[model samples]
Target: MQTVCNIEQLRTVVNAWRQQGLRVGFVPTMGNLHAGHISLIEEAHKHADKIVASIFVNPMQFGANEDIGNYPRTLSDDQEKLVAANCDLLFTPTPEIIYPKGLENQTFVEVPDVSVGYCGESRPGHFRGVATVVCKLFNLVQPDIACFGLKDYQQIQVIKTMVEDLSMPIDVIAVETKREASGLAMSSRNNYLNDAEKATAVNLSQTMRWLASQLASHNDYDKLLQQARAKIDASGMKTDYIHIAHARTLEPATQNDKSLVILAAAHCGKARLIDNLQVELD
Candidate 1:
């Protein structure tokens, strides 16, 4: 894979692909390179002729007390994985490259409502950071399609909302959430878990699945949410939120809503993990 960190080089490579009339696909990530992330790259392959993946650990998306300093950077390992995944291009821009005048001075993009509640509530300014960096990357990459993991269901909603609100030409797609044999949603943060915490973390996904199964026949949203939250908390993990909401809008699911998603987040040992399950009621 061709690696370019310079903005001009990235544009030059992408523009060449455009001139060749080759449809381009993009996957933006914070490089720890796991199966879930690779799945996004593979998803991109299905949509476009060439795939471009970016690895910039966005500081704006991180909270003040979050693990910005300690977030793992395995660029060498990531590059090898990307090449193996058949990624055509990789952009590894530094914070300086992205925010030349500094983050305080850079223009920010915020998508309202969808950016509220859930992770947005738990981590203030988080979605604003997300929208801004993604907007910046969208402008930088200018791909025909961009793929995000379903593990971040709310995040994909935020991005889809942003794209529609801004009328950006890019198509945003969500790849299915990759999971372990035990049903744990695969995440880069999963690395933070110790052996015992790793085992316990699977409970988060399991609880979501259990809630989805129950919601199939019973639409008691509040009761199911409470039960799911209780199950995760009982697993020795602190529950952040276990909410049943509209699959597309991220609003609280209503009785008339047929398409729904169970969104969840929790803390296990040193890692803060998130997962979701989508269900369509009859």
Candidate 2:
């Protein structure tokens, strides 16, 4: 795969693809490549003639106390994975290039309502950073489709909402959350977990799965969620939020809501993990 660091070079290559009438697919990531990320690129191959993947550990998406400096950056290994996935182009830009005018004056994109609760509540200004960088990437790459993992369920929703609200001409495709045999959602942050914490991490996805099964028989969303929260807390982790909400809006799921999802976030040792399971009521 050809790797370009500057926008002009990236545009020069992508524009040539456009002139040739070839459709392009894009996958934006924060390095630290894993099976889950590769899965997105694989999915992108099915949608467009060419795939473009980007790895820029976005500082805009991280908070002051967040692990931006320590976030993993395995570019050499990541490049190998991308090439194996048959990605045609890889855009790896520095933070300086991404924010040439400095972050203080950089224009940002925000999708209201959908960006308010869940992860947003705990990590303020997080989605603002996400929306902004994604918008910039969308502008730079100008792909026909962008693939995101459903592991970050709210993030996919936020991006979808942003594209629709802004009328950006690109389709946002969400690939299924890749997981281990133990049901732990594969995440770059999983590297932060110690031996004991790694064992406990599976409980996040396990609890989400169990809660999904209960949805078919129970209408008491509040009680069901409280019980799930308690189960996670008893497993030696601090519960951030264990909520059942409308899949699209992220609003609290009501009895009449047919499409719903069970989303949870918890802190175990130094890593904060999140997982979700979608539910369809008959």
Candidate 3:
């Protein structure tokens, strides 16, 4: 895949693709290539003629104490993975290029409501950084369609809300969360886990799944979520949250809400793990 670090070069290639009557699909990521990221490109292949992937470890999305400096960077390995996934173009811009005016002065995008609570509460200004960088990428690449992994259930909702509120014409596709055989969702942060921590990590997804099964039988949202959180804490991880919410709006789930999502975030070792399970009631 051809990699470009500047907007001029990226737009030049994009315009050339447009002139060729090619439909473009974009996948924006933060390097440390894994199966979850590759699945996005693979999903994009079905929707567009050409695929574009970007790897910029967005500083805005990370919290003040978060691991921005230590976030994994494997450009060469990521490039090989992208090429193997049949990605046509890769945009690997520097933070300077992304926030030319500096983040303090950079024009940012915020999708209200959906951007509140959950990760929004867990990481203040996190979605602002996410929306801003994604908005910038959307403008820079201007693809006909973009793909995001559903592992980030709330994030995909925020992006969808942003696109609709802003009236961006691109189609946003949500791909299923890629997981290991043990049910641990694939994540760049998984690299932080030691052998023992990795073993405990799968319990995050296990707890989520167990919560989902409990939801299937009844609608005792608060009790179920509390039990799930306790279960996670017992697994040797500190629970951040284990909430059952409306799948679409992300408001706390109710008995009347047919569509629901169980989201959990916890701290284990050097990694903070997140996982979710979606349910559609009959």
Error of 2 at 59 (Å): 0.8
Which tens-of-lDDT digit does each residue in 18-132 have in candidate 3? 9999999999999999999999999999999999999999998998899998999999999999999999999999989999888888888988999898888999999999999
What is the per-residue lDDT of model 2 for residues 1-282, given as tens digits with 9 covering 90 to 100?
A: 899999999999999999999999999999999999999999999999999999999999899999998999999999999999999999999999999899999988988999999999999999999999999999999999999999999999999999999999999999999998889999999999988998998888889888998998998888888899998999999999999999999999999999998889999999999999999999
lDDT minimum window of 10 residues, candidate 1: 215-224
Candidate 3 worst ten-residue window by lDDT: 211-220
Candidate 1 vs candidate 2: which has greater lDDT? 2
User: What is the model-wide C-alpha lDDT for candidate 3?
Assistant: 0.91
Better of 2 and 3 by lDDT: 2
lDDT of 1 at 38: 97
The top-ranked prediction according to lDDT is 2
Query: How much lDDT does each candidate structure score?
Result: 0.92, 0.94, 0.91
